[model samples]
Target chain A: MRKQKRGKRTAQEKANARKNITKAIWRHRELYLFMLPAIIVLLIFSYGPMYGLVMAFQDVKIGVPILQNKFVGLRHFNRFFSSMWFGVTVRNTVLISLLMHIVCWPVPLFLALLLHNCVNTKLKKTAQNFSYLPHLLSVVIVVNIVRLLCDGQSGLINILLREFGKDSISFFGDPKWVYPMFVLSGIWQNAGYDAIIYLGALSAVSEELEDAARIDGAGKLKCIWHIQIPCILPTIVILLILNMGQMFVIGADKMLLLQTDLNIARSEIIDTYVYKTGIGGSQYGFASAVGIFQNIINLGLVVLTNRIAKRLTDVSLF
Target chain B: MKRISGERAVNMVIDVLLVLVAIVSIYPIWYVLIASVSSPMEIAAGRVLFWPKGLNLAAYRKLFEMPQIWMGYKNSILYTSGAVLLDLAVMVPCGFAMAQRTLPGRKFLNTMFVITMYFSGGMIPKFLIVNAMGMLNSPLAFIIPGCVNVYNLILLRNYFESSIPESLLDAARVDGASFTRFFAMIALPLATPIIAIIALFSITTHWNAYLGAQLYLYDPKLFTLQQVINNILSRTSSMLREDISIEELTRITLETNLQKYAVVIVACIPLVIAYPFVQRYFVKGVMVGAVKG
Candidate 1:
């Protein structure tokens, strides 16, 4: 590396920085006034709750504020660890995250790539628009559809199963299939819509570059593998890092709707566990502890992934 | 541009696969709408496939009769519009100010914004804060906590930074335009695309959201459409266990399926109407971010 430039600024440069302070203040006061509402809202909703994360370290109750409570360092975390839910919650969170990365993450990319490769523009646009429709459906609505089509009585899939001379699978009732149900539905809902990013990346890759590859005698698969995927790897990495950051955040409402006594074995993940313990169980501190633990891991994963992506690809969230 | 003329066999295979994928992708939605309007007896027999056998608005009529469903609709519209209004008022100027390099306290405030994106206090803490603020059981709980989406803020900030040229600001200043005048006159006009994008997101998000309503509001009447739909779905089975004979109950059960589809269909009508516009702007917004990213 070259020599550092610390303390090396010229007198003119230093003066340039200080020249317009009063002027900038007067010129930008209206802008500052404009932003104050947003700043205050963030301070309240975002930062205030962040300060309330201290409940994780306190013996706190509802109605009573967190600071009013006694400090109980690691008591909740210790209890969480000792409890049986630690294993179940952690296992479910990780399993879902892995399934998302391994199964769902690639789907949009594949769809995007396939669409990008297609010559028919109308078909491509139609498929693209059609794909985002499911995402627009509310989770409740989607889960309702899942219940309908996955029902043992008159589910379309089970009807088809009987026609094919096979057993109709109980998707919601079975513990093993519930996770797949979550992941596959996720893929189904998001793949087409999320593929927009990859399509954007594909569009950004120059037609000239592909032509060059083709002129050099590369086949269709070869062009995609060597050129297209390579061009979009930064985008893929960025998206992957984002997906990884939310590893523990399997959504709560969907799980609650989907959970049966039969499949609670798989659906009782960290979020649901926290919700039940906090609101239903009225163990605020313990719930907060569980929440704080998962979030800390999430924060660490996000930061770690950001750093790795930054180092390897010269792209990062920040 | 030289279009690659791959093998005829390859092209045919790709076309066939694409058609299949599109069908599979849209088939469920098709099924839902068809089943809702289809002959109920035929649906129960699993004979209603690909299209409605006896098309009718009976389920829709039943849905309209339920005053609770209408209340859910009223609540949904109130929340969606209210939240979007608050969101725009907060985010536009906030994002614009953040985009200004010379804005005082920019670095500190930007740090505040970015940190919140990564490390939010968990839901319990958020609930406590909201409870402390007495935003609970009020429309404010839904509207206020989620008013300024940080991700949308980032997108808007990036848009302001890039699309609204520094030269334009300088020209406005030369014309004796104050910062507020410049924003209202110059920036706002150019920022329509960003506004549309964020608006689309806000509408869809607030419309589809159930978890927030679940956490914040307790009153059944205050429940949004998703929560209303959820209650309907969960109750369908229990509703089937009336003391009537098994045959009569089975018929009711099948009718209840139509009810579920009708509720969902009713809830989704706004989305179905708005999605064409949303699809265009949303894709455009993401593409804008992709280029920047």
Candidate 2:
């Protein structure tokens, strides 16, 4: 009688487990249907195309299937490494990126702090809207505006200088001014939009700490320095890490727009160089090789930064 | 009392400085608007400053006469609207689905989506895939590859999870409503602000997209505004100098510059008009997403 009862209990437990599995599947069926479209789209557009990266290692020819392309292991890579222009492109890319990062990253933080400190809501919103207007202007428009302002003969900038008894300067043509112009225009176009992130961070800071500081006889500046800055430090650090990770991926469109025969030496970063070679020279393999090189470097930077961030602050992009 | 008054004075000075900065920031836009309306001759001579000497719409008239400009406008509208709709169709459902924590394989799907935010199959490969799909010169090519933005999807997903209460979803489920009905009736209404934000972003991105159009479309008729403008600007010195007479050259230069500004104004105006309606939603959507993430 005891053995028969035990056997019946075991069968009941198996039945219950099967019911649970079925219920779980049924509960999640809607989610699976919803995710289907995005999954298929990403698989095709993103993951499926990853196979084409192998062409970077091949001698890719036009009109040939990527699979049929000659397998030339690391030949394009060697060519890229040996090219005379590689040093110039790498140096230009890193220097401009570093300069822009240094100058452009912190200005937004300062702007956010200033905006946060403003007592009047109307004034704050008006300032924000005005600042964000430039961000709405397309790169094409921004570049055209830059050209008009910096035109040699009839440019407003030269006209202003000439009125002050100064000679016309070829702002776009000069290599010395190229980096500065790129950095400055970048700051102009992006600072306001970037400040929104910091402003978000600033708003999250607790007000009780500021009040307590005031009660302790801390001045406004001291209170802000001690209370607010520390509160937002993690955000600043995370942004810094992310910024560093993208330090090699310079803006090719802006560089291409700004490139002239005269400024080619300074403005020809890796992106522009790859663009010139890929489209102009029709050296697809070589261009792909350079692109792959850039990706590897960027990947390394991101990993390194993530590790460092995690080690120091226990926060990481992952 | 004296120190307090001194602080107030300093604050007033800072306010004036900020106002000055704002003017400087907006000056280029003002300069272009004024210049576009000014007579090309006066603009070329550098005599017009701050405002148009004579308000004329000749450049605009000339631009309207160009068949290419109208074609560009049409292409841009088709591309932006189609892409935005596709983005929404794919992104919204996926975001809602991902928001369901009880979903099987949720962790795996989330990882897959997030992986894309960090890496991509570089541009050439993407171009090749689009070409292989026979999407070249087709409008589908422009919209399909960009159907989903992972970052936007994540934001939308997070918004759904936080804003749409679990109790509401559970109640809908208990009412014997299908998943589609539940999302359609309950969740989507709550997600309007985020939807608007993503829609605005999609429209702007697609409208300004020149690279994809340049790579895919060979037909001049299919060119978007940015692509046409780029061609005109890049080839202007050579094309005009070769074919046109010296007398007409000056006229062409002046005309082209004015037209360029006018094109800038025209291309951006629609998005600018749409912005105010979505601005309130954008601020809240961003704050929620950024703070939570």
Candidate with the greatest lDDT versus the true structure:
1
A1-318: candidate 1 lDDT, tens digit per residue: 112643786777667656766677777899889888988888888888776468888888666755788889999999999988789888987888788886677888888877888777788777777887788888888888888888877777887787678998888778997887888877878888899889988888978998998788877778789999999888898888777776666768888888898998898889999888987787888888888898889899888888887888787777
Query: Which ranges of candidate 1 are over 4 A from the true structure?
Result: A1-23, B1-6, B239-242
Query: Candidate 1 lDDT, tens digit per residue, B96-120?
Result: 9899877877888888888888887
Model 2: per-residue Cα lDDT over B1-293, one tens digit each: 76567556656655665666577667877887888798877776567877887788977787778788778888888888889998999999999999987776778889998877666656667766787788988888888987889988988888898888888888888888888898998889988878988987888788877666766788898888888776655545455448778888777776777776676666667667866776666566557656654
Which number leads on DockQ? 1
Candidate 1 TM-score over all chains jointly: 0.93
**Docking quality class, candidate 1:** medium
lDDT of 2: 0.79
Clashes of each: 0, 0
